[model samples]
Target chain A: MSAPAKLPRWAELGLLPAVNLVAALLLSGVIIRLIGESPWAALKLLADGAFGSQEAVGYTLYYATNFIFTGLAVAVAYHAGLFNIGAEGQAYIGGLGTGLVCLWLGAWPFWVVLPLAILAGAVGGAAWAFIPGWLQARRGSHIVITTIMFNFIASAVMTWLLVNILIKPGQQSPESREFAANAFMPGLHTLLGKVGLAFTATPLNLAFLLALAASFLVWLLVWRTRWGYALRVAGQNPAAAVYAGILPPRVTIAAMLLSGALAGSLGLNELMGAQHRILLDFPGGAGFVGIAVALMGRNHPVGIFLAAVLFGALMQGGSQLSFDMPRVNRDMVVVIQGLVILFCGALENVARVPLAALLARLRGEKEAE
Target chain B: METYTLIVLLLAATIRVATPLLLAALAGLFSERSGVIALGLEGMMLGAAFAAAAASAVTGSVWLGLGAGIATAVALALLLAFAGVTHRGNQVVAGMAVNIMVAGLGPALALAWFNLGGQTPQLEGAGQRFLALTWPWADAARAAPFPGLLYAELLSGHNLVVYFAAALVPFSAWVLYRTRFGLRLRAVGENPSAVDTAGISVTRLRYQAVMISGVLCGVAGTYLSTAASAGFVRDMTAGKGYLALAALIFGKWRPYPTLGACLLFAFTDALATRLQGVALPLVGVIPVQFILALPYVLTVLLLAGFVGTAVAPKAIGAPYAKEK
Candidate 1:
């Protein structure tokens, strides 16, 4: 096989990723067909469930909100040459922080609790990332392994907190009691209602707004700011960055803190907005999912946004598919997502050969003409 | 005293629990030494566990179950190796994606075939499970004194997998250090160009390394489902793959060190299991969470404080470029 030749702007920025995504979806379809379900029917259901109705759209967006935070978190770190796999643990700890703040200020108004809880969550998430970040910067320990270990550490800590220490008097399940109504953040339905548009009720809440704002800010920070330039430069070449007066340690620490904070806010959407209670496995697997999102998005803000939406659609739609189709279980949905992750992120190069050949041939023809 | 019995039980449990960790760490040793990190070790182990249990239950043959488990793990390894080593895509991402795929496929396939809540049917009867090996003097041990009892309790009764796990360390050490193939493998991990210049195929070496990783993981998984427990459950490996990776590091990636690290983790695990309720003098009553978290915390500490730029093979996680 020939080496991958560079593609034009559109293909590089768009066509290639789209092809990879389609390849992933097709493989997922084959997996479904192997299980005796019609892939077309599954796709139809997924599309309808994810986008057919207002409520469905709302749920999709709500899931997207968490993904956005996590995707952006992973992207931020990636741009700085760090793979922040600790986002799951960071989100868990961030939710812990959100839960603590909401509990402490249970009687407070929404306005008072919201900002404080967000801050607490950010701090909590950042704190969890700090040790690994510090080690990577100072001790030369690899961040990926340490961050993963931190996930287990966070899970054990969360389990300990939820079960033995905070098991809500006599509740069987290891979840805290619902937070006070005053601590509940406003949902998007209420916000939309205030704006005179009727919308379906959903877990989609002010957290979605926070996530959008974060996306915009990240785009600005990474592309439009001087600090971002330094971070990227450090990622590209640490020696050159140092020669140019950028400190690797400082850049690493800053990027990680920002990444951790964004990841942590993913929990706020669930705990403070939707569930209003902290529980076991609440982050679920969103942190890992963010890796796929960021990879598919190429670590860009707009790319991450679109990627998050697609994954969000898959999740919300997959849930409905499992409910409607007994043959296709939740594990099937996971398989699809896994396929997406594998093709789009891991085996992405599989498509580069033909694409590069085609692109190179077209370029040569144009030059000859 | 009661402490003596507790000590013996804890030691035995330590070996029992350490078996999976040892096998998995040895698996990690192969992959990492050949420069492809097996982050999907968790997924491979979990998938292998489910496959082994399900196959054993269906065929009523422990060997068939082991084969099935090995086949699944090697299949996953092939995917990872193709992506990471051949296509030269990112190794960490490829491994992670494979892990997610395995995590999904194991339960999904289990559900399709068994319909028992993503769990395989229990492995029953004599051939379906690995029976504990009995010593020749077991009858006399029951009738006789403390030494016999100690011998019976400590030396006898572990399943065949434990013995295999024990033997694998020296075997791996011999393969990795004493042979020409081992020399080439280590050379490929440290400097692929040097090996390639010597007319060795780096791709072949790495593929073999990763496949060896797959085989070790299969053994680890079979032990988990067939011997460690009666059947496969969802996420039965828990985080043992990562624990094994940590042990690989804690052992400093050497055969002996890896074994010692697994022992330490297993000992801590046994302590956590045993010391759940008992109060101690110096430390007071330690919480179980602390003990459970001990292995992870130690791994982090080792990475941060003690390792001090000492761990990991050079060129690890890097794709070897043939021309560049």
Candidate 2:
């Protein structure tokens, strides 16, 4: 019954997450083997596909941009001690907002539509999340269950709207018409070419930069502000927060609103930047991936940024691996994502005890010397 | 007479649909009643569905498939226990991990094994799938008309698993209320420290409860692929597991009330299917999506209204640790 020693900040933030990631990857490798494939060969191909070319890197960053938006969404809600699993629905609604604005104002210049689209996206997502947030805060409803229900509700609503109301006239598919060229989100390559820079064509766009900017803003809002402080206090200790005149209900709602708005930005990249049309499942499970990112990143902006890139690499590379290996598929990445969530989030303490004991022994040896 | 017959058919469908939900809700009843969050019910069912279907396809035996399903679900339940119970980690996060993992793992393995794009080969023939059991002398009874048709149509022709699910509810009530294990399980959920002090191991009781949950989910999932549908498809459970969770909550964690909720939800689901593209006199054609979304919307409303006052177990979601 030895008491575990406390970990230093650096080890706590960096080393522990790194060790957990390695463990997750090892389990993933075992899964790869179980599927009758060589994990090493698959890893090599995955690495090459993710980083071998400028095009691959761009794709990775493009996927990373979506993760960043969603990762921050989860991180913000986590900080407020709320598990806002409705990010998927929020992102879907947010995409709807972007699509509506683009369809209605396609005649306008890019500059005019972009800001309005962004605002609409955030508002749409926040509106979708508001119901669960209000229910949790004012009515004592469990956020997790309510949010899960809302995901199905959102899916049904989106399907109905797309199939019946929003489908392009005379088209057999359940998707809207493409946006005008003026309304298109300029890709990084196109924007770079205009400035006389030689860059390969890819889907990477200004939203990537927007995601980084959002990360910085999240850090500011979550750490540097009074409201942020109050939010943290409320999450950490509700009784103390009440004594300090911070209302838990208010914080809960506000945090959910912010989280939903951030999640809404996923559409800015997927719909506005890539698809340019309203389609089914545009969020593409990125909202769920964000939970993994947030957990791995320890709910910090910088960590989330790195974790999002790692997931983005997996997304980009897994597709590449699927092409090379007939037996392996992109779903393998999801298996790894689950492992990461399991090792890093659920079984986090499984590693902590051993690491602490090892560190204590090493420190003792150094002191004796 | 046509309307009456249609109503009877609808009732039959409701009973059929309610089978899986009832099984899963009872599964959840065990886990949550023991203070462990059973959010991974969806994953458990999916894993079992895939295992049952795949095993049946390979072995050509329905009983083997049943065994495989139960084994897979029990393994997943143990994993949840390792994470949520032994490690004292966040139960919700652990459940989500199981869900996400199974979602990917099922398809990945399916693609690798069968090369059929995440689907097992369809279960064919008598031994590979569960067939409906006609009650004894059902044809002779049908000749009597009226109540005979009702008995023949509604009660007589369900697969064995459906009957098992129906019977399991009373069995569950008996086990939950009358057994000493149930008393200890309930005591642990309500106050683990008290139970711990009473010379009982909280972890063991919780583990037993969770394993029982797994077994029930296994049966439910097998019933889905083998009895309800032909074989497992990707995400074939669709939202049934979640619907069961909602039913569990709606019932306030009781067996009989939970069965009522499942039947109610199933009835609505059947009505949605029947009402599709059918115009009504006053309401016109209600969107099928709206009807499909009703159960969820109702659950949310219930949670928000005064009815949401349903109290959870005292130690629910709290990781129990002895005083150091």
**Candidate achieving the largest TM-score:** 2
Tens digit of lDDT per residue, candidate 2, span A51-112?
88999999999999999999999889898889878899999998899889999999999999
Task: State the lDDT of candidate 2 residue by residue for B1-324, as single tens digits.
Answer: 778789988999999999989999999999999999888898899999999999999999999999999999999999998888887888889888988899898989999999999888889987999888899888788766689878987889999988899999899999889999989888888999999999999999989988998998998889888888888888888878899998988888889989998999999999999999999999899999999888888888888876555566778877788764
Recovered native contacts, candidate 2: 0.87
B-chain TM-score for every candidate: 0.96, 0.97
Which candidate leads the pack in lDDT?
Answer: 2
Give fnat, all candidates: 0.62, 0.87
- Chain A TM-score per candidate? 0.97, 0.97
The CA lDDT at A99 in model 2 is 88
